[model samples]
Target chain A: MIPTISVFEHSPDRGQGLARDMSVRWAFEEVGQAYEVRQVSLSAIKQPAHQALHPFGQIPTYEEGDLALFESGAIVLHIAEHHVGLLPADPNGRARAIMWMFAALSTVEPPIVQREIAMYMEHDKTWYEKRLPLLEDGIRVRLHQLSSRLGKADWLEEAFSAGDLMMVQVLRRLKTSSVLGEFPNLCAYITRGEARPAFKRAYDAQLAAFIGKPPKQAN
Target chain B: MIPTISVFEHSPDRGQGLARDMSVRWAFEEVGQAYEVRQVSLSAIKQPAHQALHPFGQIPTYEEGDLALFESGAIVLHIAEHHVGLLPADPNGRARAIMWMFAALSTVEPPIVQREIAMYMEHDKTWYEKRLPLLEDGIRVRLHQLSSRLGKADWLEEAFSAGDLMMVQVLRRLKTSSVLGEFPNLCAYITRGEARPAFKRAYDAQLAAFIGKPPKQAN
Candidate 1:
């Protein structure tokens, strides 16, 4: 049986492919694995049934027979471990690739998310204008480190492992902001990730889900 | 040879066990692995050699013979995957444990870090007091969900795994904040994790590293 993954019925990103599920879907496409998506609405996501699958009431849970998993990073890792394309076979290379995954989520993404939260949740606050620069600077620190590391490399490492997939996805969240554009190499790095054929397929799939979806009012 | 992990020579946290290295050390102790620590001062951490090991130039990098890995979450997972005590042997249990590792780092730690940034970076601003409640509330939401999911259970799942290790570390960040006390079960969960001999050993090791060191000025 094909593994099942859950996604937003009406994604808050409005088909921008910034949702966590997009990366999971991209991983599946990269591995040539066919899976099914179960659409979940915002309200239904917090319900008991959904909460059982994800304690934090978030999206992109994976279920394969008796095994269940949440957290997109973990789900992507699970897919990468089961499939060959997303991770390297060499022990050291694989560990380094996983390191990138953690860096992308834990190190890079948090500052970008703080900026997102400020824009979406606290835009009306008096400190909003004053705080935007600090938020941007926080992201730039990470971007500079990432750019230095990505210097002239096609991917984070030798190949486009799940690390690149996660890092690229996290960087894409900054598409609306000018902070990512300051580092030309970083921008090119994201471009290369988006240019992947598997990424295109996954992007199109998430975009299709957004079509005919009533625009989400709440995140 | 024992694996080598790098940590801050003069940790900003003043040996409070909030630094990411604390969890990595805890994981090692949990698994009964004897690992060596290489102390990294803040300036040295950003040097080329350090950046080669960790792209972000952060601490708690794992080096064993030819393998080098960074990111505390990844290092902890690496230790868990290789050791018996940190992860379950069964496939499903292991995946769930890893899922919690991601959840703790990706989901729970972000808000906590955001609050930390606000407090440390923006404390003198006029908006600090007004925004402090919002940050605390943000933490409360996650704590509430985690507490509810935890209920009276001694651990997150059937037995203590790396999930508890990561979660407890994440929660310990909130020890200074009153937000953690709102959820008694979560507190007990942390208390239970701390009660473990492995955790005590890890905590003592990190604490010992801070002895006689002039307190760090920069984060």
Candidate 2:
């Protein structure tokens, strides 16, 4: 049975694939799994029905028969666990890959999101200019640590598993800011992730959601 | 061989068990796993050897035989996956339990941490007074949604799994603030989690680390 995922009806990111659903969609694409999407609006998301599926009433919920799940990280992990391509076969390697997923969502993304919240919502505040640099500093620290770890490696671990998929998505958020550019290896890493055929397919599908058309195939 | 976990030599949260290691410790107690603790000072964590085990250089990191993992959420999830008491045997129940772990870390905890950052680091900033309310509102929204879902239920799901463990820990952070008090059910829910023998054992273990004593055993 094809799983259905919930995404934003009108993505606030303007189809740049920055929405949480993009990661889940990318995971599905990476595993060559066919799935459906159910678009939910900002207003409707707060309703009881949507809240039932997701306690936080957020997007990118995975519904497969009796199983209902939210939190993009969990949904992506679910897809990766059920499929072959997104995770390695070895138990140790698989556990390490899952660790990266948590690291991406919990550690890396928090500072980035804080920066975003400050920029988007607090720009007019008195502390905007003063606080912006502090947030950026936090992001730079993470990026530098990540860049140091990546070095010349193609992926975080051995192969391009879901760990890289999640880390790349988290890093992509920094593209609008100049923070990501500070680390050349990190920038190239994002470029490499985007170059994957599966990522292209996922990106196109999300972009197409905005235009009300079928998703374009990857070249 | 017993697993070893690295924790803060001097935890930033003092002996309150707010440290990430508390969750890992709680998971071990719930699963009845006896683990050794390796205390790492903040400076030591940044060193090359520790950084190899944890790229982010944070605790608690789990090391069992050849398998080493970081990210508190990942480590807790790893403990839950391997043990019978932490995760349900059924796949759907397991997926939902995992979802709450992500929700606890990603969805619910971010605003709470942002609020903490504001209070601790940005207290003297000009916009602290103004921005403080916004952060509280963000936290309130999450608590409200979570409270609604958890209404009249013993746990988030059918059983008390790792999901509740992670959520309860996240909520415990708000005990210092009055925010958690606003939700009565949520407050009681936290009380229930704290009343658990396993939770007491874990909490005492963490507190004992601060006083250089052995952890109190569960009755």
Candidate 3:
């Protein structure tokens, strides 16, 4: 049976693809998996029913048969593990890919998320100006290290795996910020990941869902 | 040859077990894996040598043979993947377990970490009081959903896996707050996880490392 994942009925981003479900959709499309999306409203997400699917009342949650899963990273990993395209076949390489996945979520994403919180919620606070640079510096440290490691390589690791998929998604959050441009290679890498046919499909699909239309085919 | 993992030479947490390396130490102890800890000071962490292993200069990078990996979640997953006890044999069940691992880091840990930042760094801010509750409520929502699903179950799933291991660690951050007590089942569940011999061994080992002494055996 095709699995169903939850997404926002009307995204807060207004079709910007910042919604967390975009990653899951992209993963599914990359793996060529057919799935359904159950659009959830903001109020319904906090209710018990939605909470059962997602402990945090967040999108997206994956359900198939008796199996239910939350956390986009987990959902993506599940898709990657079950499907052929997302991971490497070599044991060590596979483990490294998984490591990159964690690095994206745990190390890299935290600072970027912090920056978002500061921007959206704490903009008026007295400490906002003081704290913004600290957060950005933290993000820059990670990005600098990532860029150096990535060097001239197209991806973070050997080939494009789930790790690259996740890292690209995390880096995309910095697209509007000057932090990304600080590292030229990393910026190009993000563009490369974005240029993927599957990613284009996923991005367009999420954008379509937000705007209430069907996804446009990539040119 | 025995594998080696990276850790802080002198942790900023001052042995509070807040450092990321604690999780790696705990995971190693859980599997009875004999490993060595290579200490990296904050300065050295930023140096090229350390950057080679961990692009972000974070602790708890793992190396076995020629393979080097970073990110505590990824390192723990790697250790769990190679060992028998951390993951289940069933494909779907294994996927669920991995999902929980991601949920712990991505979904559950973020709010708690935010609360920490607000309390510690932003305490003097005028909006601290107003913002603190939002973050706490965010955390509480996740805990509530988790508790309801747990529903008197001993573990998050049927058997104790790496998912539980990571979840328990993440939830432990909320111990000082009464937030966890708001949900009885989750409190009991964390207690059960803490009472495990493997967990106890790991905890004590970490505590010992911090205290600069051997681990004490619990009665």
Q: Could you say which candidate leads in lDDT?
A: 2
The ten-residue window of minimal lDDT in model 2 chain B covers B210-219
Please identify model 3 stretches exceeding 4 Å from their true place: A124-130, A214-219, B118-120, B123-134, B214-219
Kindly provide the TM-score of model 1 when superposed on the true structure, using C-alpha atoms: 0.96
Tens-digit per-residue lDDT, B1-219, candidate 2: 788999888899999999999999999999998898999999999999999888887888899999999999999998888888989999999988999999999999999999998899899988889888999999999999999999999999999999999999999999988888899999999999999999999999889988778654333
Q: Which prediction has the highest TM-score against the true structure? A: 2
- Each candidate's interface RMSD: 0.7, 0.8, 1.7
Question: What is the C-alpha lDDT profile of model 1 across B30-58, one tens digit per residue?
Answer: 88888888899999998999998887888
| By lDDT: ranked, best first | 2, 1, 3
Top-DockQ structure, candidate number: 2
Model 1, position B155: C-alpha lDDT score = 86
| lDDT (C-alpha) at residue B171 in model 1 | 93
- For model 1, name the residue pairs that clash: none
Encode model 3's per-residue lDDT on B1-219: one tens digit a residue.
Answer: 678887777777776666787777777777878787677788999898998888887787889998888888998888888888888898778888888899889878988988987789779877678778878888887787677777878887889988898888888888888888899888888789788887777676666766677433322
**Model 2 Cα shift for residue B105 (angstroms):** 0.4
Candidate 3, B162: how far from true, in Å?
0.6
